[model samples]
Structures are given as C-alpha cells and as structure tokens.
Target: MKTMKTLLSASLALTALSGCQPETEKPNILFLLVDDMQSDAIAALGNKNVYTPNIDGLIAEGVTFTRTYTNGALCGALSMPSRAMLMTGRGVFEVQSDGMKIPECMVTLPEQLRANGYQTFATGKWHSDHASFNRSFAAGENIFFGGMHPYEKNGHCSPRLYHYDRTGQYKETSFIGEEFSSKMFADAAIEFLSTAAKAQNPFMAFVSFTSPHDPRNQLPDYGKKYKAKDIILPTNFLPQHPFDNGELAIRDEQILPPPRTGEQLQEELALYYGMVSEVDEQIGRVLNALNATGEREHTVIVFASDNGLAMGQNGLLGKQSLYEHSVGVPMLIIDPRSKKHGFKTDALCYLYDLYPTLCDIVGIEIPASVTGVSLKPLLEGTTDKLRDDIFLAYSNQQRALVKDDYKYIIYNVEGKITEQLFNLKKDPKEMANLADAMPQKAAAYKEMLIQRLKEQQDFCNIDTPLWWKDGHKITWDELINLYIFE
Candidate 1:
C-alpha cells in the first residue's frame, strides 16, 4: 500500500511539473523596414497607382494600421531619433543626443530580446549614431545610406555601400550604391535565418531597405519593366507649389522646371514605381526563403516604412512639410498566434510603439523606461483606444496635434498657425481647412500642441529655433563629412 501511494504521488507531481513548465514555443520575428515608402503606395492601403502584391498579401494575413505615423518626415530630421525611439521604446526627446553617441544607460529592444534568448541579427540602414548601438542586434550590419549619389559612380556617399558590424564597426567594403546593397543585405539575412533555424533558436531579423530613396536607380531590366507613357500623374500634381508656407526654399528651388507636362512627369513616376516594384520583388524573395526554411507559420512578419515621401503629392518631392503624404507611413504587424488576422486598426500609433509591441508578442516583460505602450491589445482587437492624440513636429518648421478627425498645424518658422479640421470620414483629401469656421475647436487643439511642445522641449533639451534667423543649407557630401563622420 505504501509503495502504491508513493507511485501515485510521483505521478501527480510529474503532471503538476509538466503543467508548470513555461511554454518554450517562442515565435520568430521578421521586420522589413523601407526607407521612404508612403502609406498610399501600397495597394492594401488604397494605393491604386502602384501594386505591392506581396506586401498587400502580408496585410491580408495580418493587422494593418490605417492611421500610422512616423516621428519625423525628413531623413536627417527624424530618421535617427525616430529609429532610436522605436528601438528603445522611448520618445526622441527622451534620448540624449550628446554629439553622436546614443547614451549607454538605456536598455534597447534588441538588448532586451537578446537577454530573453533571442538570436538577433540586422542588415541595412542604421542611420542612427555609430552603427554599433545596442539597439540593433547581437550580430548585425548597418549602413548609413540616406543621401543622394550618382547612380553609376562611387564618388558620392551611397546608402548601399555603407556597412557596419555588430559592434558598430564599419566593414571595409567597396561602395556600389543601391542594387548591390539590397542584394547583399538580403543574402546576409537569409544566411542568418538559416543558422538560427539549424540551431533551433528563435531569431529577430531586421531587414532595412535603402532603395527608392533618392538618385532613384533601378536594375536595368527592372527599369525597363515599366513604360514611362503608362504612368499616371497624381490629381494634386501642380506646376509649382503656390506658396512657401514657411517651407525650406532650397528644396522648392530643386523642383524640375515646368511645363512639367505629362511626358516628363510620367517618366519620373515610372522610375519611382520601378524602384518600388524592385523592393516589392525583393520582399517576396525574403518571404519565400522563410517559407522554404519551414519557419513561415511560426514567424511574425512586420512591414513598415520610416516615413512617407511626396513623389508628387502637394507639389513636393521630399518629406519636409507638415502634410499627410509626408507624415503618414505604412505599418502592418502579423502575429499568427492571434485570432484576429486581416484586421484593420485606425488607432493613432507611432513607430515608437513597435519596440514594446514586439516585446509583448514574445511574452517578454518590457523594460520600465519604455514610453510606448504595448500594441498587442490593439492588434488582438481587444482595445478601442490606442492613443488619444498623436503629437507631430518637424525640426523647426511645423508642430501639430492630431486627434481622430482633426489636425492642427502651427508653422513656427513663419509665425503662422493653420488648423485643418477634416471630417476624415467624408473628405480624406483634406481639401478644406476649417480653422476659420471653428475657432473654438482650433483653440483646443492649439492648447494641446502647446502642452506637447513644452513636454518635448523639456525632455529633448532643445531650444526651439528662432524663426527670424536664416537657416543654413549644406551639400550632401559636406553634411555627411561634417556632421555624420565627425
């Protein structure tokens, strides 16, 4: 009887131990970050001109954020700080930009994930400080590929040739610019994935693409894929932007002289679309590799851009102004563990939230210093509120606060404040600015902007630039050699 009782107790204990053992089935993460692709360029996001079938397919199999935003629109303006925010789960202002060093005290997303047993790897574009920030991954590569350069020559700084090892050390490599960089990064990522799969270790692969940014060069064959005459011009296309509205006049001067007649515009659009299509094709390649590795179903894929671009929107070619085309970005998160797939959320979520969201999806406790909230609840279709209001600001040009249906922009450079309250449900174009009609509502938004500015100023240690002073313009090479290399 005693032996039988002992045996029964042992069996019960084994059962209890089995139930208590933590689930070891962790999900792999694949993050695809595009440099300047706009939200409207993807077919899944209502873009009719360009077709991004693979990205759209990912959206159909996951959650797509309709109201996603980036921290800044311009490349140098917000890419570094915004990326820092996304990596650290903190706001740009919260990070101390002392010269070029990212403070050592902060616990970054990759570092945290590494602690949680994730084998992390990254490739392409680390526009932030030295390529060696802990925010990236344990083993990775970073290339400072944000500027414009000649397509055929290697004289200028190319986003493609730039590369760094995990410690942020620049690898000695020849500069070939975009095409080669994309291929190399993709190849490196595939190798990393293969290693992780063999080791049975969950991996976080961050693939940042530098194509479709500038000096727009497409593969010769890819460039030939589209005919210039077939391209369509945007409805908002204009010969010249009516007014500066406190915008940088330098970029305005760069506008290709008009009669930007149908022919020229179509040619430019064709090249742009061709570059985008090349990126889409590369994305499909990566996804196929994942499937071939038998990790497709267990992996979570995220597609997002740093910010949007204005190929021809609002008569702009870059992302400097405070416009929807510049601020909004495409953000899609796919979690196979969740029941809610192919869902759309219009909640105001920022790129900074991605750090915390990734942690949540992997069942890891987010560090206390992170300012962003977990988006899993929102992705799971459990939360109705993602953010009450999103604060948008540029270096010294514009500051705005966006609620559900209203957007208020304060042009600090020109000492002019403009408010546009759009019934997004009715007019998504934002053709009408209702500030003149609804003074009280505009005032409320202005107050919110003021509070946000104050908080940002306090945290960032930034003295708002005096608008009366003239701004300086530096050449691409000069800027890179001076500010970046120094």
Candidate 2:
C-alpha cells in the first residue's frame, strides 16, 4: 500500500509537470462576475421567488455549480486578494504587499491567455493592488471603482483606472452607476466583444458588476418591482444576533434595530431583492448581446460572486462571520463545447480553482505556482469528484475546513479561538452545533484545520503576522488610500 501511494504521488507530479490539454478548440471566454450576490438570490439556484430569468436562462444552457465557495466573506477582506489569486492562480499569500505592487514574478491568467493568442479585456471593480492589474490584462477599464466612491452617488462619472504593463497598454473609460453597474459593465464588454469578433480573435472579457452591495439602493424601476409589504422575511431572521460571536461592533449594528414585525423585515428584504433582480436583468442584456453577435455557441460563460451576503440570516445583514450564508457563494460555468450541461456537482471547489480550470478548459498550460487543481475532468463528466477536502481562511479572523458531510469552523477573535462543527448532510441550515457533543470528532477536525492552514502557508507563502492592529480604526478614505498604496 505504501509503495502504491508513493507511485501515485510520483505519477501526479509528472502529470502536473507535463500539463494537460482539452480535445476541443479553444473557446472565447466571457466572465460575468457580480459583487455581494448571495447564493440563494438566483432563481436557477433554487430561489423560487427571485426574478432572475436571464441568469436562469444561462443555467439552462450550462452547468450550475451547487457547492462553489469564495476565499473570503466580505468585500473589504477578500476582493483584492481573491482577484489576485484568480488572476495569478496563486493564493493571496503568494503575492507580496510592497507598496501597491503585485509580485512581478507571477504570471496572471490574462497574461498567459494573451501569450496563447488571446486578447483580454476587463471592466469594473479592479480592487487588487495596481501592480497586479497593470501587468495582468491586455486592456483595462473601471479598475478604480472599488475605492473611488461609497454607496451614495451611483458610481457614474468615476475616473477610469488603468495600468501600463508589459503585456499591453490599459486605457480608462467612463463608467456610471445610474443605470445599474451591471448594465454599464455589460455595455463595455459587448463593445469589446464586438471588436474582437470582427478581428476573429479568441478573447477573454471580464465583466464585473458592483451591485447588490450596501447603501441598499436600487434603481427606481427595480425597487418598484416588489412592494415592501410583499417581500418575504428569511426563516432565520433574528431580532439580534446572539452575543457578538466575535464580529465587529459596527457590522453587528447593521442588523440591529431588528425589524419589530414581519412587515419591517419584508421591507428590507424587498430592497435587497430589488438590487439582485436589477443585476439579473443586466445579465439578460449581456446574454442577448452575445447571441446577437452569433458568438454564444463559441463562448464559455462563467457566473459567480466575489462573496456571499447574510440577508437576515442569523440576524446579520453583512458578511463578517464564518457562517455558510456569509462565506458560501454561487458559481456557474457554461461551456458550449462540453456535454455536461444541466449537470450539478456536489464536490467541494473554491473560486481560486477557476484560474487553472479556465486554462484547462481552453487547452492552455497553468503555471507551477498555482495552488488550485483543474476542474476540467469534473466539468467534462469524466470524473465524479474534484477534491476530497476544501479549506477557507479569511482576514486572520475565521478559518474553516470542509469534507464530505462535515464542516468545522474556527473563529479567531481578539487573540482567542472558538470552534464549531456541523454535520452538513443532516443540517444544511447549520442550526445545530455538534461541537460539545462530540469531543473526539471536534479534536480530529481541529487537527485537520491546522494541517490545512499549514499547507496554505507552505504552498502560498502566507504569513501569520497580523497586518491590521486590533482596535485600530480608520476612515473610508484612509483605508482606500492605504490599500491603493499598500
């Protein structure tokens, strides 16, 4: 058995070095990324009441990921790092924070695709350090939208953020949030695709929408779709979250002043749903544009969110906890060349995996520094599983590891650690805590959690040092400047 295990490991190492390719011709890539979208907001993903026909149509045409996850729960915590990981195929730790530069040595996904004779274009929400964005893509737009404005004014008229890097030059374009950020991004993406189609070049277009985020504002038409009284409150709504559970005080207050009656709860949910529906409508428009260009069949479309939000779950409105509602996101990938349409996989997967997975699907070689495995086999219906275990870590505050039917979360707050375990198969809602009842199981999971963190450290060069001091408070502008210059 030992010898067989060693042989298998050696074979995997060789396979990794040799690289693998897909049988089909390389396909054009269209990435539809949304900000602060919850897992249950889309109709195709099991939300019966939400109006997401455009997104649902995409699901009907492609495979819907049932167990997709993001690197972090909050935009401020994971947006930049997660994006860096996606572009570089490396975890957040692999990239160093030297002023505002991403590690120059790392080759981003866009750069690799460009090298393979593909053109890349991106619009909206480049939250990562300027260094990463500059060196990564062929053309860039709206990268500065992340820290430029708060939820107040529609993000319209924001300056165009660009980076001049080795791959190519980046030019700024005008952006406005008046007509929903998703629609604006889609318009930019459609323009890029129209040009690419004319040139007959395989292209990658990343359309990022900054919507369904805070300030809870929505377009007047979308907001009018549902009356506040008609909205439905979440089943887990709580007047107040039990204790802090070690979450930030400011964030905790967002969910406070809890709705006194179901009507109040419904009012808040209506606004939230309104924001989601607005994004969905924009998605429809983008899909229609693709069809109109006659490139829908030749393109591979991927839909995913940066992170999940807690819309009244556990009395929480934001994503600052380790709960499933906060960290788990929806991911869908539709490849016209694959036969696995309408299939769902329960395998554990992370957003970081999309980088290598794309490389695999498009018949390109992934770099050696990438920590995620290719999901091509799973997508191709050749394999029933992807990974045996999935690990997640965020902001030095929460850590979690999940296996088949069990998940363990370790909450680290103010230098103290607390643990919780759940049998996901039995209680998907995670209402029951099995930690105290099963000491041996908890201990075993803890060991696995430690090993997972250690592996991430070794593979991604993640440092355990806390960059943000406890109790340190900074204004929004200051934080933005710090991130921009970091």
Candidate 3:
C-alpha cells in the first residue's frame, strides 16, 4: 500500500474526478423559549397593544406559524407538559409527565443532537426534571428548574438554580437573584454563545425565559411606560366566566377573582405587556451577542413559547382552558442562509412538531420515537400545509375540535355535559353559540369531535349520550336546566 499522505491525496483526486464535493458546514441552532406568550401578544404579529421589538425582529426575519398550539390537555402544571411535548415530540395523551418530570421517551431533541456530534448548551428555565435536563444538555448554566420565578410583593425573590452537572446529580443549587430572571438567562446565553464560537463542532443553544408569565414584577420601570387606562379589553372579556368548566379554583384564576374590576384587568394587561417587552429587550441582548460571534452566519433561530395564556379572554384568566386564547402559541423559524423571510403559514400544528422540524433543519435523522410531523416542507417552500383540522382538550372536562374556522366544544363538568359550536370566521369572538339554532351542523361537529377525541385517546367516556342523533344531549336534567336558562 502507498504512504498515508499519498493514499489521502489519491482518494481526494478520485473523489473530485467522481464529481463529488466536500460537505458544507452544518448550521448552528438557537432555540428561544418564552413562557405564557399568546399567539397575538407580539406587536409584529398584529397585536397593536404590545411592545416586543426584539421578538418582532425575529418575526420580520423568519417564517411564522400562525396557528401553532400546545398539546391542548395536560395534567399537573401546564408548562411542564408543554415543554415535555416539545422536547419529546409527542402529544399530551402520548407522553406521561408526573411531578414535572419528563416521561419515558426514547429520545429528546437535544439528546438526539448531542448524540449526532452536536454540542448543546441550555440556560434559564427548564421545568422538566433534573435528570432529563442533565441528559438533554452537554453543559448549562443559570439553569432554573422551577415552575415560576419566586416572587415577592416588591419584586422577584431569591430563586434557586443549578450549573451543569456531568454526573446528572445536580445536587448543588444557587439562589441567584442579584439580576432579574430574563437578564440572567440572556447573560448565560451570551456566555454560552461566546464559548460556542470557539468550539469547532456545531452547537445548539436553548435559552428559555420565565418572564411574562406570572409575577410580572421584574422590571418596574418597563411597567411604568404603559398606562392602565390605555389597555384595551378583549371583546370576549367578562366579569365572570360564563360557567365553571372546571379549574376555576386554580391559582391562575385566583390571580384576580370574579367581578374583575375594569381597573384591575387594565392594570394586569399593562403590567403583562411591560413584562413581555422586558423579556424582549433581554432577548435582543442575546441576539446582539449572537451577531457579534462568527457562528451567526450559519445559525438558525427558533422562537416559540411553551403555551398561551388568557389574561382576560374568554371570561377566563388562566391557561387551563381550551379556548383559542389559552391554547394558541407564537412560533417562528429563522434561517439566516435562506432567502425566505417574513413569511407566515396558517397550517395548524402543535408545539411537539419542533423535534422533527429541527432535525430536518439540521440534516439529522429524526428518530422513530418522535411522533410529530416535520414542517420542513412548509419551511422550505415545498408545501404550505401540514394539517387540516386541530384537536384540543382540558383534562377530561373539555374537548374541542376545529376545522375550517368552525369550532366545536364539549364540556363534561362532573358529568353534567354541555356543548358549544361557533362559526369562527363570522364570530371570531365566539359571541354566539349555534348549538341549538343549527342542530344539524352541531350534530355533525359533535360527531366529528367525538371521533377526534377517540383518535386523540381522550379519557372522557362518550357512551352516555341518550338521544343526540342530529340533535342535543338529552341529559337527566337538561330540560330543567334549559327551562331555568329560559
């Protein structure tokens, strides 16, 4: 055999002769996750009431998925399941989260990338368990493993966090409160990006911010920029929820009680907008750091929120409901090398789909364990749609299905079942319920919802209907309840 150098030269010559070229550098990935951000909360996304310049910039330079949502129904805390679904690439009924621990999935997005020659760094809030977080990231700092940042009346309290642990023990924790949460996470992100720039291997940085969630007291100065009286109320805002679809007793609803004063809701909206703007500023800092690095050329940015929140929409103030305000989330995928920018697709999709979508973006093989369908076609201009209809549930209490801008909702509060249907195109506010007026359409949608619920593995039983053939549920006392309403 020839010498090693001669052999390499000969191999290269043969490769060139065969019309083969060297592989291009794989792109770096930056996944930015926000907490409790609704689809319409961003100023760039047509929310005139908010000020999110940095996030708006991402929207300007990326393709937005206008109809992205969470897994719809989850038990325990909402954030945990939403993030779990994102990482594992599975639906709500598919994954099992207990005590905020990630379910037993075959692979996580970061873990898969790490196995495939990518160095992964994570910062900020990771509501999943320590073991999962440790396995997911190659290294991390300022890792907040809690639900929400600890809050005091004045501002944020000392919150516990952890540095990366190679052994996955994560035993030691630090109470870091010197800086606000969003700034702390952005600081960690900038540091990680700096290190990533020096590394030869392609890297992934996940910066998750717990801002704009609850305890919106971090940046008092930002909150001061907005007037409470100027905040506009949602068309569906009501002093009280029309009915207890269950979960009215949760802490989210208790943030402000029933008969919500106009001043109270306005103040809430103002502070919430300010909180989002604060997070947006911190995010801008992180983006500036990225641009300063050489790694910016081939990096792809994925901006998304875990789930949406209802500040005062649908007569509710929490995320535990299955209404549009509660389920829909903002999503954007920014590829720097691509010419496609500021595009949007209303093709419905869920948060879990990011796993396959990211894999497709990075040229990695999506594992068999991932159940989410990739949006690579949509991103690459090969297709504009992936889903025709969507399904949502809130525990076993509420189940909903939407197709072609028409929505059907079924409420099973303690087995006292009720139904609602709305032609969303005409009444986007859901001001009218056509369940009784259009019995035929309601019956059709109810059947469709049941079929979807079965396909989604809903826990609620559907055999209790007495006489709902092209009509309404003949409940044990529905007639009396109807008379009472009449």
For model 3, give the 10-residue run with minimal summed lDDT: 477-486
- By TM-score, who's the top model here? 3
**On residues 1-486, what C-alpha lDDT tens digit does candidate 1 reach at each position?**
223223223322332343333234888899998767878887777766676788888989999888888765322444565666777777645654511334556677877776676766777766566543545465653344443335566412334454333345555553454444555566657656665565445778889876666556445343225677777777776655545545545442254553356666677777777667777877888888888889888898899887777666666666776667778888989998878778998888888799889988988889887888788888767767878988886654556778878887666444443445655556565556787888888888877777876866522111344332443322334323222211
Instruction: Give residue 28's error in model 3 in angstroms.
Output: 0.7
Q: Report the Cα lDDT for residue 461, model 2.
A: 15
**Candidate 3 lDDT, tens digit per residue, 1-486?**
233233223322332343323323778899999999888999898887888888989999999998888867445367877887898898776665322556445588998887776767888888777788867876776778878865553344355666665677877656565577777778778877776666556778999998788887545343225788898888788887888777788888888987687779899998888888888988899999999996677899999999888888877888988777788899999988778889998888998899999999888899887889999888888665588778786655677888888888888666567788888789876778888898898788878877876786655555554222322323323322221100
Residue-level error in angstroms, candidate 3, position 314: 1.5
Q: How far off is residue 319 in model 2, in Å? A: 0.9
State each model's CA lDDT, in order: 0.65, 0.65, 0.76
Off by over 4 Å in 1: 1-24, 73-77, 98-101, 141-167, 171-179, 250-263, 414-421, 458-486
- Candidate 2 has an lDDT of 0.65
- TM-score, predicted candidate 3 vs. hidden true structure: 0.88
Candidate with the larger TM-score of 1 and 2: 1
Q: Which is superior by TM-score, 1 or 3?
A: 3
